[model samples]
Structure formats: C-alpha cells, structure tokens
Target: MAEQLAQLADDRALLGRTSTAERVSDILRSRISEGFFPPGTRLSEDSIGGALGVSRNTLREAFRLLTHERLLVHELNRGVFVRVLTVDDVEDIYRTRTLVECAVVRGLGEPPYALDALAGSVEEGRRGAREGDWKRVGTANIHFHRELVALAGSERTDEVMRSVFAELRLAFHVVDDWRALHEPYLARNHEILQALRAGDRDGAERLLAVYLANSQERLVEVYRRRVGEDG
Candidate 1:
C-alpha cells in the first residue's frame, strides 16, 4: 500500500492545476487498469487524497465516478474497493467484445485501412514476451484490441470499450498464470493484423471471433476454479 501511495504521488504531477474529479478518476483508472491496485483492494480516501494533494471531497467524487464505471464499488458500511469480477461478468465482457470488435472489422470501408497502431501494439506484445514480462504482454494484448476498436473512428464506441477493457483488466489481474493467459494471443493478434493489411476483412473477422471465443473459455475456466478456491 505504501508503494501504491508513492506511485500516486508520482502521478500527482499529471493533475497539475486542473485538479478536477475527472482527471483524478483518469489517474486512478489508469492505475487500476495497470494492475497497480488489484481487485478487492480498499481505496484509502485519506491516504489517496493526501498523496495526490486533493481534498477529501474531490477524492470521493473521483471514487463516485469510478464506481459508475464499475471499476470500484462502495460497500454500505465498509468503503470503496476495486471491483472483483464474477464469472458472468467475464462472460458478458467477451460477448460485448465480440459484438463490437467484429462489427468494427466488418464495417471497414475498404482495404489498406489504418493499421500502424494495431501493428505497433502487436509488436509491443512481442517485445514483452522477449523480456519475459507476461503482464506487460497481457497489457499489450489489450492494447491491440483497443486499437482495433479505434479503427471504427467513433469516440462513443471508444469510450464504451475503454470502460469494458478496464473492467476486463480486473479479471486479468486475478489470473495466476499471466503467460498462459496472454502468450497464445500474441500470434493471433498478428494474424488479425495481417489479414487486415491484406484487405481480407472476412478472414480477419473470423480469426478474431475464434480468438475471442478461445480466450473467454480459458479465462472463465480459470476464473471458476479461482473463485471457488477463494470461497
């Protein structure tokens, strides 16, 4: 917790003078998505506020915004904590991913689509693998999909999936074997990128559908076992 507080202090520079609840929530959201604050960890209002040099009211409002995004939850008496996803939550997240992502690919207007960002994300994952940093690999994998969604060119879709993917990270944080969960997708993401580069949108969409299905199945299996063990 002390380490996390120190990290918050480091990020305080990002707030500068704006100091809005939205900016505070963005910092907290990024930290949460990065697995710095893992699932079910209580968010200390006083400590976080002090660390970020924000008032208690400002911090609470930031917490309230995160709660709306389903990244944090407020217990009636206990306090706010990072959310722990359920099996059904995992299922629904993948469902939403499949729907939105596949449609984005299918709806692409023509070949030679803007794919540099997507390719970069795939390379990022490969670099993480070379470094034996499976968590970084996992993050790069999410970055690949987020870039894929960005191909749609819709801010609203991007906003919605931003929340969905952040929630997805909460699920990822619980899995013990990061390599097992993330390594296989490195090639699949590259495959999707190749199909897009070749103007094979159909093939790309098919590959992505299979990729997401397999991933969801594997994660839910592990999630059930892990949640059951905890119970």
Candidate 2:
C-alpha cells in the first residue's frame, strides 16, 4: 500500500502547480478514479498522509474537498470513506451530461474546432483498450467528455462537470464487465469526433445524446443492484 501510495505521489507531474491541499486532493481523486480507493473503502488519514508525505491538516482539507465533490463521504462516527453512488445518482449525472455536453455540441460554431484535447482523449482510450487497461480506457472516456464540455466555452460549467464525472465514476466501479462496457465506446467516440470534424454539429450532438442515454441505461441496472436498491 505504501509503495502504491508513493507511486501515486510521484504521478503528479500531470497535475501541474496546484496548492498543497489541492495536490493531495488531486492524488486522492486520481486514486479513487483508478479504483485504488474503491466504493466504501475507508480513507485512513494516517496511512495516506504518511504515504504521501503530507501533513494531517492538509490531508484533512483535501478530504473535505473530495467530500464536497461527492467522491468521499464523512460518516457520523465511521470516518471518511469513498462514496457509493446509487442508480438515481447515475441517472441524474447522465441527465446533467445531456444538458451540458450535448448543449456544447449543439451550440458549437466556426470550423477551426479545437480538437486537440478531444482527439487526444479518443486516442488515449484506443491505446488503453489495446493494452487491456479497461480502467485507463474509462478514465480517458471521462476526459473525452470533459473536453467535450469545454467546447461550450464556460469555465464554471467545466468545473461543475468535473465533479459530476467524479460522482459518476463511483457508479462505474460497480460494473463487472469493464472491457465489454468500455471498448465499444472507443469507436463511438471516434464517430462523434468525426461528425464534428466534418462540421456536422447537429450530427455530433445527436450522437452524443444517444451515447449518453445508452450508457446511462446500462449503468442504472448495475448500480441499482450494487446499492441494493429495491425495484
């Protein structure tokens, strides 16, 4: 565990220059997304702080931020644990994505559509799938969506969408067929990107809406069972 934490601490070069608390939060957030801290896993401040070489106060602040983002939860007496999102949560997240992401594509203007981040993410997903790294593929998929949101040109929306994806990841962790679930989306993403590249905003938006709707439907059932929700 210490070794894994040490490696996580070392992977922050991509995180850029953030505050100490934010750096710790970013590491913890990445770990959560990677399934290092799976749903309901208790976050031991002592172990995490020691492993990351951070102070207690800073770790606590980081924990608070994640908690606020719905990635972590603070129980009355049980301490902090990774959040376990439910079916309703998944549905709500998809609904939010439809509103934000599809809206971006619908409102897109001009031809020089900045495709670097979006294209890069699709390629990343393809590489991850080739390597049998389903988790990496999943992360790249979220990155693709986040980049999609950026197309809307609103920083506030991007910030909100990030939290939405973090919560959605909790539900995704419950899926058993990771490869079967994520592999098909790689091509779907490329198709959407192609539609955009061809200057077909309506086509891209339509594909995105359908893509998100289908994904939400599939995840809803898994999450319902995972959270033991009654029919």
Candidate 3:
C-alpha cells in the first residue's frame, strides 16, 4: 500500500486541523475504491501512519471509520485488513445503487442537465482505455456512478455511495480479466452521458437500471466461479 500512502501524501494539505480523521478515512476509502489495497490485504497502522505523516491514533481512527463502513475488518490477534465482500454484500450494494442512482435520474426536473463531473469521468475512462489501464477504467467507472448520484445534490447520498463503491472494489479485485470487466462499459457510459446531453432523461434511467442489473448478475457469476476454484 505504499502507492496508497503516496496518494495521501500528495494531498496531505487537505487534512487541515478539523475532522482530521474524516479526511484520513476519505483518502483510505479512495485507495480501496481505486483497488490499491485489495480485499484481505492487511493494513499496518505503523506503516500507514508513517507514510501519511499522521499519528497511530489518527490512523486507527480512520480504520475505525472504514470498519463502520464495512470496508475494513479487525481480526482477532491480527491487524486491520480490507474486507472481502460476500455475494450477498455485492447484491445488496447493487440494490442500493438502483435506488440511489436511478432515482437521481428519475428525479431530474429538466433534461440535458449534465454535470462536468460526469463528463470528466467519462473522459478519464476513455483515456484509461487508450493507456490499456483497466484499473484506471474501473476507477473512472465508479466515479461515473458517483457523479450520477451527485445529481441529487445531496452530500449525505454521496457519502453513502462512497462506501458502496469501496465495497464493490472487493469483487472487482477478484476478476480474472479486468479488461473484459471494464472495456465494454466505456461505451455504455458514453451512451448514458449522451442520453443526458440529448435530453433523454428517461432513456438514461432505463439504460442505467439495465446496466446495473446486468453488472450484478455478472459479478455474482464471476464470484461463484472464484469460490468454486478456491474450494
């Protein structure tokens, strides 16, 4: 997780004085969602604290916050590790996305209402594709969904989705082929973006619902296969 620490290092000034733990947790959460710390990887308080220039107490506080979010687990006689998501957990996350993301679209008061955040995320994914960086593509995909939920203009909703994406990354890390999992979605995301740009709000909502449902099914199938092979 050295790379994870470096990212936090780069953004160190964001911590400020107040709510330091929350800021630390945000960086750690981003690392998880970006797949830097994959599922079940042990997170050492000493190492992370040393790297981020934070105290062990602050780092532990961040771990505690993530633990509450279901992104980290504290094991007996062991250190904190990234959570390994269950199939049920995956399904529940998808369910949450349907209600949260699709509702954002359904609640739109006007068509062709697009945020640069969403457009920028799509651009990021395309650039990732050009570089053959499937992990980057996956991260951009999560950002796209986050931008979608942000349309509701709710800080509380964004907070909920952040944890959701971090947990989803657990399943993503186990995929046998990252490109296969992420490449197809690039164009799909573009289509969703274009729908919004073209004032096709209902179309966008329908597409997202189907896209999420199909993704859930594929994740379940892939997860079960991994379980069988491991067994």
RMSD values for the candidates in order, in angstroms, are: 1.4, 2.4, 2.6
Q: lDDT of each model, Cα atoms only?
A: 0.95, 0.86, 0.86
Across 1-231, the per-residue lDDT of candidate 1 in tens digits comes to: 999999999999999988999999999999999988999999999999999999999999999999999999999889999999999999999999999999999999888799999999999999999999999999999999999999999999999999999999999988999999999999999999999999999999999999999999999999999886331
Give candidate 3 misplaced runs (Cα > 4 Å): 1-19, 229-231
Q: Score candidate 1 by TM-score against the native.
A: 0.98
- For model 2, residues 1-231, the per-residue Cα lDDT tens digits are 666677766765644555498888888887898788889888888887777777899999999999999999999888999998867778888999898898889888977699889999999999999899998899999999999989888999989998998888888888898897788899999999999899999899889999999898778877776678753
- Model 3 weakest 10-residue run by lDDT: 222-231
Pairs of residues at least 3 apart in sequence or in different chains that clash in candidate 1: none
Model 1: number of backbone collisions: 0
At residue 76, give the lDDT of candidate 2: 85
Provide the clashing-pair count of each candidate structure: 0, 0, 0
- Evaluation by lDDT, superior candidate among 1 and 2: 1
Lowest-sum lDDT 10-residue window in model 2? 10-19
lDDT of 3: 0.86
Q: Runs in model 2 with CA error above 4 Å?
A: 1-19
Over 183-218, each residue of candidate 3 has an lDDT whose tens digit, in order, gives: 988988999999999888899999999999989988
